[model samples]
Target: MKLLVVGATGTLGRQIVRRALDEGHEVQCLVRSFQRGAFLREWGAQLLRGNLCAPQTLPPALEGVEAVIDAATARPTDAIDQVDWDGKVNLIKAAKAAGVNRYVFISILGAEKYPDVPLMNIKHCTEKFLAESGLDYTILKPCGFLQGLIGQYAIPILEKQGIWVMNGAAPIAYMNTQDIARFAIAALDNPDTVKRSFPLAGSRAWDSNEIIRLCERLTGQDARVSRMPLGLLRTVKKILTYFQWGWNVADRLAFTEVVVGSEAIIAPMDEVYETFHIDSGEITTVEEYLGEYFSRIMKKLRELDYDREKASKKKLPF
Candidate 1:
């Protein structure tokens, strides 16, 4: 399969490209800057310089592509209308013009339910455009990523011995980005996956308390768990917004609210496993992921210390 991956430089996009390459597919990445995407050349991906916000740059990227996986997203500095909605609409038009066979889109869970939210609203609008574009499509509505949670909360626990959680004991499942890549690839050829949408999640759900307990057990490190009120987060978001430095914090807070407040966002583990023929046991759990992550950091630090000691033992050139 000859595949074109938009947002190929992004976290999930890069994972999708890697998985596609491992499967022996020819991959091309549409990137805005060649310098940032120089590594893609080494990874065997053909780079097509383009920006999602600029529709004129897409036709060349879409040419000769059999399928497209759109993983592009709006950054904190970007408005949802320009990058998320209009950008995707442009890509869809180009893909259709190029006679692309399949279009795979990565969308967040609860998009339709959160129409008032800027980002979610844009995603919902893009999904609608793809559905009516008269092209074969697959929409993946995945839950919060495990890697994201680890980056946001796990490191704080390891370094500061504490983590903040909203809505005590509220459970949320975190999906792996690699699993999402697998599903996206599967959609390219699976007849059943065409024009179908999937709500994805991890094997199990964990609340803040469970997360802290698992971290302590895995790393053998004790950390304090602080429960935060939803109202407090809302207030903080308002303050940050007033200062015009709150987009990132506001996005996180909004997502946290969804995770803590909604039961519908949780994907049924058994249903996902059975329907997709996936074994949840094979997926990386939050505890396992954190253990490996912290171990790597410790190992790197030890290597750096050893290098410093070796340098100090050498005689000075003077």
Candidate 2:
């Protein structure tokens, strides 16, 4: 099938494009510029110049597109209403008019529950729009991304920076981006996935302190930890909201509310695995994922040290 992928340059979007192409499907990406998408073109996926903010740019891109995989999102710096919500609304309309067969959407876990969080609210609203758009759609709500956690916690720990662990941060089942892509592409074919939504998560849910301890053990170093009270976070978020330009910052701060809730952000995936015909054992765990990352980073650091030692020795008299 000829497929159209929105947000093709994103972490999860690129994976979907790569996997979709490997599966022998014709892939097209909707990007704002061809230059930013040069690598995507090199990957053999056709690039269509378009932006979700511009509704006029969408219909043309959806032409002859059999399936549409929308992994696009607004950044913290971007307005969620314009990009995430309105942009997706336009894309949904365009896909409907283009007579697209199937649509796959990526959403966060419990999007509707976190109405105060700007990003999550927009995502939930988009999901509702997509569901009611009279199109065949599959929504995949992911708990969290392991790749994000690495940057948020692991790298900071290595640099001896303050690890921001909240008073009562929730445990999250963080899955690898590659695995989510697998589920998204798999949904493109399975009839069972149509008009259905599934939660994609890792084998286990891990909290902040647990992850911090894991990183310390892996790198053999103590983390510079910053434990913020949940009350302080709320106060900061409230203060930021008072300013016109600080709304975006405040919105992001509200995201912590989702994690600090009564229960962890997780779901039962036994049925999901069976429906998608995926083996539970194949899922990547935090230990394996983090272990590989630390190993690679440690090797690079060791190589850098060796080069420095070699240069220093050359300057010595002996």
Candidate 3:
């Protein structure tokens, strides 16, 4: 399979590229900057410079492409309306024109229910656009990414910085990007997955307090926790909505509804596991993921300290 992977520099996109290449498929990555995508080229993926915002830049990348895995999304500083809405609309049209067989779109867990939130509404609109575009497509709605938790929780705790959370943050079944990548590639080849939506999730759901305690246990460090009332986020969203410069921040803050919404943005993936022919046990749990991260980080810190001690001892008069 000759595949075009969007957002190849992202956590999930990079994993999908690696898996596709490892599985003996030719991979082409659509990247904005060659400098940013240099590592993907080193991994044996062909790079085509393209931007979703520019519809003309997309078709050339899709030439000779058998499948498309779109994991692209707007960055924090980016204009969400342009990238998520206009850009996605362009990509779907271009893919349909190119006669691409398999199209896999990575979407969030509860996009359809949140019309008030700009990002969610854009995603849901894009999902509808693709579904009605007369192209073979599969939409995977994945829960929170576990790899994201490292910076948001692990590093903050290790560095003794504030780990911020909503007062009553909901428990999320955060799936590993590597595992999500596996399922994405599986969907790309499976005919049954065409025009269907599947929930990609981890084995267990974990809350903020549980994760903080887990981090403390693994790193042997006390976490400086800061709690924000969800009500304040709603108020901030309302104020930021009036300002154009603050649109991105306001769009992000709109995601707070997930924490307070009735559905917890998680799903029982027993049917999904069976459909993809993946076993439930193969999914990485929160504990195993955190445990490995801390162990590796601790080892690196120890090696750095040992090197410094050895250098100091050499300079001393015994």
**What clash pairs does model 1 have?**
none
What value of lDDT does candidate 1 attain over all alpha carbons?
0.82
lDDT for 217 (candidate 1): 73
TM-score against truth, every candidate: 0.87, 0.95, 0.96
Residues 1-318, candidate 1, lDDT per residue (tens digit)? 999999888889998999999999999999988899888878999999998888899888888899999999977677667888889999999899989999999998878987656678788888999999999999988877888867557787668656777764357678778888888887888877788778877767877777777777765678876778888877876676665566666765665566677363577656655656777788877777777887897788789999999999999889
Error of 3 at 232 (Å): 1.4
Q: Which residue segments of model 2 deviate by more than 4 Å? A: 315-318
Model 1: worst 10 consecutive residues (lDDT sum): 262-271
For model 1, the superposed segments whose C-alpha errors exceed 4 Å read 224-226, 238-253, 262-264, 269-277, 295-318
Displacement of the residue 245 alpha carbon in candidate 1, Å: 7.6
Best by TM-score: 3
> Candidate 2 — which pairs collide?
none
For candidate 1, give the lDDT of residue 109: 82
| Candidate 2 worst ten-residue window by lDDT | 253-262
Error of 3 at 289 (Å): 0.7
